[model samples]
Target: MQLTNKAGTPVQWQDYLKSGHRIFIGSNAAVPNALIDNLIENSAQLHDIETVHILTFSDNVWAKPEHKDLFKVNTLFIGGKNVREAVAEGRADYTPCFISEIPTLFKQNILPLDAALVMVSPPDEYGYCSLGVSVDVVASAVKSAKVVIAQVNPHMPCTNGHSFIHVNQIHAWLTAEQRLPEIPDQQIDPVSERIGQYAAMLVENGATIQIGIGKIPSAVLKYLMNHKDLGVHSEMISDGIIDLMKSGVINNRRKTFHKGKTVTTFCIGTQRLYDFVDKNQHVEFYPSEHVNSPVNIAKNDNMVSINSAIEVDLTGQVVSDSIGHQFYSGIGGQVDFVRGAWLSKGGKPVIVLPSTTKDGCISRIVPHITEGGGVVTSRGHVGYVVTEFGIANLIGKSIRERALELIRIAHPKFRDDLLQQVRKHYWVPTYQDNTPTSVPELGAVELKKFTLGGERFILRPLSPADERRLQEFFYSHTKETLMMRYNHHLTQMTRENSCQLVSVDQHKDLALCFTQRDHLGEIIQAVGRYYFIEASNSAEVAFVIRETQRSKGMATTLLLQMIKIAKKRKLSSLIACVRRDNAAMLKVFENAGFVRGYSEDFDEISLCLTLEETITNAKEIE
Candidate 1:
């Protein structure tokens, strides 16, 4: 790698990044540690430096815990190590995104940068330094940065690869002999190996591939050596790909974008693979923005991206790095590849996971996500979901159908419970002719309960084992449902309970009640929602519920239950609201001794149940 100034003039040791310049560091393991060291070393002299890095590894030593006043690492995704401190200690912040669109953040100047720090191998006779192992959007960083510092390393493999900066392309150089951080060998489990086989089966000869790192990704690569011309335009590559390369599988000659070039951004593996990627012209490694960008990635048709997950709901909500509320990993490139592959002609972005956990106690698929679970790829963005059982093409499906499909593929022991959960959470009637309505296209992944001789079926709380069926449910219904759940708001949903169990023992002014779901096996479309039935002074009362599971009678039942419980916790009159067209709902309030009120707004009707009136009604009935 060589250095040059912005005006095409070479600088020996110029500080291109001055005050007020926004800087973009490579995301993940591709982050330039040398550049970060330089920034840390020079931080005392710099002010208001906005640093950007996506899903970076343990490099936060430079985003010093004590240096918050000087540097700000504004991130789009929250990786595991930095998440805890970021949410609580307020260090590195979280940005919600699918991996597919990160490059847009840079190209669109959503977060502008003043400079870019890139790491590369020494330029070859052709006068171009290879970006080495990683290619994800770093090219966008290099393209947008006001200044560029090329850090040339000798130990880095000069493999002919993707990342590139022609000798005339860069602005400055900080030559140093540095070691690439080592990532231990990724070991795959037998189940993951099966999933890898399934994922690899989807890849055809002459297909261009994009893959992230991890057991599932590496395992998929392990099974791909026998395939032919399996070109790669990926963000990162590990040792698994080396075997494929040596076997003459990843030739990249037929690739439409970087023809005859295996493109990538960063790589991690044993030195054997590292040596394979060094300054190799056949391999062109660049920045993530270029490699991961939907535009750049879309250039290669038949791009197949294989990613993994912590959990995938039946409705296609992918929770790859988290368990409900806790942050585990960042959304790296799941969405990027999913979307890129979706947009590419004949492309497929696949999320591969095992059918069950180690204990077989929990299914990885689910009808819905856990509480506080982040929906990374809203159903629309997902295409295929694979497990050892089979593949489910969830695109354009109803959540109901998606849930059904997910259930069929779930671990046999856990499928029924997951299906029960789907019914409860989705509020859907039993499937007819095996055509469920959980898919988003027919309707959004909603509670699909329609009248069955005046009785309605309702889905309750969803578990992880119901993902496929939920995905099919989205496909089963009309797109109207998707827009309602993900796009449009079908009803007003907000958690109204001040007396939540979470608020218990806070010793605050509110009376917090302990809500219990001792029965995780309870069947409903969702945990309909808890109502904080509140009774104010002068015999006034009201109730509120959360948004995910509205119109499912939790509020009405909770209100009636509250009236009894409050009679035990002691209260008088109870009041509630029922949208006029909500006939079944008005009956719930009326049946609970509430008197319907004539309001100017029929859409929002009021109901009142006086204790005196209720006692009189009980006496009359007696």
Candidate 2:
């Protein structure tokens, strides 16, 4: 298959073409527009040529009815409007495959490529041209193809890693001074912002993340400005991360794999992002086979995968690539990252989407996916599911439990209907009413940050998922602290007890926890909660802190947060029963405006904070 450029006006690339040839074009923004134009211009010269690509732009020209006899299009993923229509009209075919395995399709000759037209950066001093933004499966395609053509552009960024190829490997080259295309940032809506806030709470400092490109990913990054030492191991990235990198919030300092480098297969972003990656050693672009390899991704500890979904069922099944039976997008690298991230030590695989669609007219959380919908992610693989309303932890939950958990996070307007469906489907215990009974929407609880002793601390409402953390906190407390809080000696803190401690009934109780995480992971430093006393406007409050964190004003801080929530709830007062000998606990409650009172039993003292009086006093002082 030796090839040589023919002398002509349009470069006569047709001279190198033949009937029945299988050609692959670079994906997304890296599509070789110049080479493609040449192919279309000479469409009359070839017959039955097969063209393969993923999420290509400007595909309508090639899929036109006039070229039906000459060319047929095969898309690995649909990224643009034209290709989607082409697929719907039967003008083109689509091959649904995971992005990670697409490279293998070429490597194994399952889809042997005759030629690969790609865009690349100009050859460096060593005669190596970088693949620029779209390495992905293009690297494998180039290797498997008999002829490789390149549209070398000066504006293309010369990224490192498996992104570079020797100039001699290309059969033909054409110079281009044009700027590469860009996927502009998406507008972040209110639903996306709420989902992002919850997703960000799961991302700890020093965790490696694999985020897709879209409005949700953009929104999620905005809330992470305060996070530290984050790393990227995603398939693609956009402009949202530029500020984080510049702010030193995402330094990739603690990654277990590819430490100190941001690894991605391709990038779809504006010129600013391209300029930042150009000749930047800190960012490495690898082939999809490598970047999306689950084995490779799992090597990074604390991997947090954030991906979007179209619809999820009550059973935790995720349908991301399609709406009902219609093809919307490709499987892409979502499954790759989801499985990889969950397998990583301390990893969190999250699925995020709005609870409703179409102006809140439809619920995305359904009892079952539309009749013929595909499940991109199975129930077993799903761990965390976040909607604008809340976060649902599905891992290790039973079918009955999953139904309850998902319904809890659904839009309130639809929860009642969803709950009825759940009850009909499963023989779960009956509730008094149709108001959805679920593990509280803990992720919706706002996180308050305060500085104590020059160290920042986060206080947020607790969720059922906090059972494990609460257990750790309980075990970490000394016997003396435990006795003071529990009013007796308790040696073990079981999961059931921990779950009860964190569970909030929204109407009757509100539990808040003070948490902080280091290299080991998130630890509950303290717990503060107020439970309603039946038939009374006043609530009983309790507080506990780890021995190591005591005497740091943490208790006072928790007390203040409890008071604020109680006041907002319009509760008349908050009461707490404390041991007479627990001077530290007594002082904390009193310091936060609590008025001490003697209990009927002398062994314990009652601390009460009258909200109406306190509010009046505060207003007066102000």
Best candidate according to lDDT:
2
Instruction: Give RMSD to native, each candidate.
Output: 19.3, 4.8
Q: For each candidate, what TM-score against the reference?
A: 0.61, 0.85
C-alpha lDDT of all candidate models, in order: 0.61, 0.80
Candidate 1 residue-wise lDDT at 128: 79
Please, what are the lDDT tens digits per residue for candidate 2 over residues 75-169?
89976777787777898888999999998888788998989999899888999999988889899999999889888878888888789889888
The residue-by-residue lDDT of candidate 1 on 52-156, one tens digit each, is 766665556546666666667676666535444664466666676655566677778887767887777787889877666555666677777767776777765
